[model samples]
Target: MEKEYTIRELTKLCHETAQEKGFWDEKRNIGEALMLIVTELAEAMEAHRIQDQANFKEELADTFIRLFDLCGGLEIDIQEEIDKKAQRNKQRPYKHGKIC
Candidate 1:
């Protein structure tokens, strides 16, 4: 069977896996989500400074995976949000970029 899964579907799988593995509980998973993202991002930045290939790739994947899990647990529509954010960013100019 030629099967395909949407981002939402795949994200839900991550959530399920997390629940089964005790990575999350009955409530929201935002705590774990933020930890996974921020920590990995910091680690990735350090890895980039020293050019650590394995840790960089691992951090990148881990950050993305946590984002997926967060979306699944929070029922966030990421694709539509990304599209909206893209349009918003387009409307902003380099002036704001410098100010911010």
Candidate 2:
């Protein structure tokens, strides 16, 4: 069986790959990375609009990879933050402030 990688490990790999590809060179700003993340989300939205399941899945993965790359670059613990947010969300009322 293949080894399962933790979120942190995957993120580190993304960061390394970005560096190797010159995507994180001195000329590029963090805002560019953020923009790429948003672009991936837009692609996902377009895929969903057309009901393209394969593209939707691929775009979602792209979004996550961009996010993970950013988080890895910033030295953020995304999994830890996710855990904290999940615990906090559990204390909220049903449906919270949303109408639906």
RMSD values, in order shown: 3.3, 1.8
Residue-level lDDT tens digits of model 1 in 2-97 = 668776676887778877888665665567668868998998899999999899998887777778778877888776787899899889988757
Reference-based lDDT, residue 38, model 1: 92
Model 1 misses residue 46 by how many Å? 2.4
Candidate number with greatest TM-score: 2
Instruction: Give Cα-based local distance difference scores for all models.
Output: 0.79, 0.89
Report lDDT (Cα) of residue 88, candidate 1. Answer: 93
lDDT of 2 by residue, 34-91 (tens): 8989999999999999999999999999998888888988889988898999999999
Per-candidate count of clashing residue pairs (backbone under 3 Å): 0, 0
- lDDT of prediction 1: 0.79
